[model samples]
Target: MKIRCLIIDDETLAHDVIESYIKEFPLIELVRKCNNAIEALEALQQEGNIQLLFLDIKMPGLSGINLLKSLPKAPDIIFTTAYPQHAVEGFELNAVDYLLKPFSFERFLLAVNKVRHKIELESRSAAAQGYFTVKADKRIHKLNFEDVTYMNSIGDYLKIFLKNGKVIITGETLKSIEESLPSNLFLRIHKSYIVAVSSILYIEGNQLVIAGASLPIGLKYKDQVIDRFA
Candidate 1:
């Protein structure tokens, strides 16, 4: 499967450099080259199914960050810019990687390789049914199905507790994470909590004990929770 790429930069030289570098990797196919954000948007709509974007930050009209913000569903981005300050903002947007100007082909290959690995993992994950990947601490964290004891919602993040006394704090939402896990092996026993079916030690009134920790079973969820045990 080729990684269809789009180059959006005000500099023709930057486009040329990227195009030349990408030629070394036969798996990458250049889809289109656009001058500005608007052109990029147009190309995206017209081209459709672009998997990778090489976006430039300082263009004539809209900035790369702003352009990335505007897309409802964006492709994997590798920010190719002269400015180093926007690197933080780019990562916050979940870009695959950031490349400063005058970057080597080795560096370029490194970023694209990350995207390739990510794509392959996603494909494999969809087919296999054992673990799920979560992004945390500026890296991808893989959580095995049997290891996770429970998950608790902490503000905008989740505190995932494992059976081995490890806790992973991540930005993944409870609802989203719940949907990702196998329904047969996990249960949402509360609005803010999800527990592994095999981890529950016993039910104690409105709460269930799992791995020596007490987790509440919401009033609304009690019936279904009891039915699961029944």
Candidate 2:
């Protein structure tokens, strides 16, 4: 998926220059451009999925630094400004890169590459830790692979059974969930059921015992399940 981006700057010329530079990157999609921090804040609250920000440090009302501070969780930022003094402060806020005013297209490209690299590293780290986020009950839930015992499908929703006896209902399909889960940790034994490979206690005939519950292994999946153990 393309990285969604937002440009927040008071100057029309700054917006034009950034937009022109961004067109060279097919992977970056500019979603919105804001004149100031307040407009950017409103856009952020409404969209909630912007991945990258081209932020100017100094603006008329609310400075970009203050805007970043106000956000509970800010997206990856690349500070663009005329003043070089704020570069130190921006780095303290974990900005990917800082570009001074009248920056060349080459410099903008370099900064964008840094943002892409940072995002890639973060994704790899999250995957390595076996952590995934899912939306449930109007909130995002961060779950670990070890905490999930199995998943059951009911119509259009999925019921995720946890080791602690708590079930989370999410409006997601079994296939989608299966694709997101680590194959080495989770195994699809049936069309409607996916069990954690480490949680399997035993297999008897065409059924597998997991978390003290017996779950069926589909006829077509039985061979693969046996092969997994073999």
Candidate 3:
């Protein structure tokens, strides 16, 4: 899969150089190039499938580092900047690599190679994994997809209910868990709840009955839920 990329920098020269380097690889697709973080934000809002970002730390207005922090689910980042001092901060933000300004095309390739490996690993894991792992009570827990009855969001974590009346509370967002689940087997009936399509016993109005628990279907999701189970 071609990695969809966005380049955010203030320098025209930087944009040209990065674009040139990216063009050498058929696996990289440069989606948009922005002169500042604000434009990058606009681009991100408009396009949800952007998988990678080439960001410059010291932009004119909102800095690239701040923009990354603000995103709810930021994509993989490679920080390209003149200031080597920002390397620590960039890595702290989980950037795949830091490219110093005046970097060689060879250096750019090395950085992107890391991104490609990361993408490959994520794709492999998502496609092959049958269970989700979580850290709870100072220990690791694995919840198999087949055992999951429903999932509910509780503040920063998710409360996952099992078919055998077991509950596992973990620091996982509903959105993240939903993305990991098989879409054919799980139906997101509400913003806060995702129920196993097979475990659903009945639907009472806008609520779904699963494993003897009633979960409300959000108004925005009601129609889709009904259509799926109808």
**Which number leads on lDDT?**
1
Q: Write the per-residue lDDT of candidate 3 for residues 46-146, one digit (tens) a residue.
A: 54356799999998879988999999888899999999998998999899999999999899999999999987777667646778777778888888877
* Per-residue lDDT over 138-173 for candidate 1, one digit per residue giving the tens place of the 0 to 100 score: 988999988999999878999999989988999987
Stretches off by above 4 angstroms in model 3 are: 130-230
Report every candidate's CA lDDT.
0.85, 0.84, 0.83
Q: Candidate 1 vs candidate 3: which has greater lDDT? A: 1
Over 4 Å off in model 1, which ranges?
A: 129-230
Ranking by TM-score: 2, 3, 1
Q: What is the lDDT of residue 66 in candidate 2?
A: 98
Which of the predicted structures, 2 or 3, would earn the higher lDDT when compared with the native?
2
- Candidate 3 TM-score, C-alpha based: 0.59
lDDT of 2 by residue, 1-230 (tens): 35668999999999999999888886677878999999999888654346799999889999999999998778899999999999899999999999999999999989998888876776565458786667799998888988999989888898999999999999976765664665567777887899988899999998899767999998756755777887
All models, RMSD in angstroms: 14.9, 11.6, 8.9
